[model samples]
Target: MGSTVLDVVNLIIARVNAAWWWASSGSSGPMPL
Candidate 1:
């Protein structure tokens, strides 16, 4: 089945949140945003 727009947005948001959390909690340095 094809993915919906909401699904795409949710995926993007999840990725951003994961990255933010990682940046804050990880020693990888500050977030790119």
Candidate 2:
């Protein structure tokens, strides 16, 4: 049960990081197709 909760937290963090990276990349330059 504890491990499952940790897994969920990690997934959320990864998603947030991906979103932040996408936003920063968009502002800095054109995105790839």
Candidate 3:
């Protein structure tokens, strides 16, 4: 049970980080891309 919860939390964090990276990439200027 605890492992399942931890796995879910890790997945959530990864998704959040990926979303943040995508958003920041879009928001950055062309120089960064």
lDDT of each: 0.80, 0.73, 0.72
Instruction: Please provide TM-scores, in order, for all candidate models, with all chains considered together.
Output: 0.69, 0.67, 0.67
Ranking by lDDT: 1, 2, 3
lDDT of 3 at 14: 86
Cα shift from native, residue 6, model 2 (Å): 0.5
> Per-residue error at 10 for model 2, in Å?
0.2
lDDT per residue as tens, model 1, 1-33: 689999999989988987878877874765645
Native-structure RMSD, model 2? 5.0
- In candidate 3, which residue pairs clash? none
Give the top-scoring candidate (lDDT).
1
lDDT of the structure predicted as candidate 3 = 0.72
Please list the residue runs of candidate 1 whose C-alpha ends up more than 4 Å from where it truly belongs after superposition: 28-33
Error of 1 at 31 (Å): 11
Which has the greatest TM-score? Answer: 1
Off by over 4 Å in 3: 1-3, 27-33
Better of 2 and 3 by lDDT: 2
TM-score of 2: 0.67
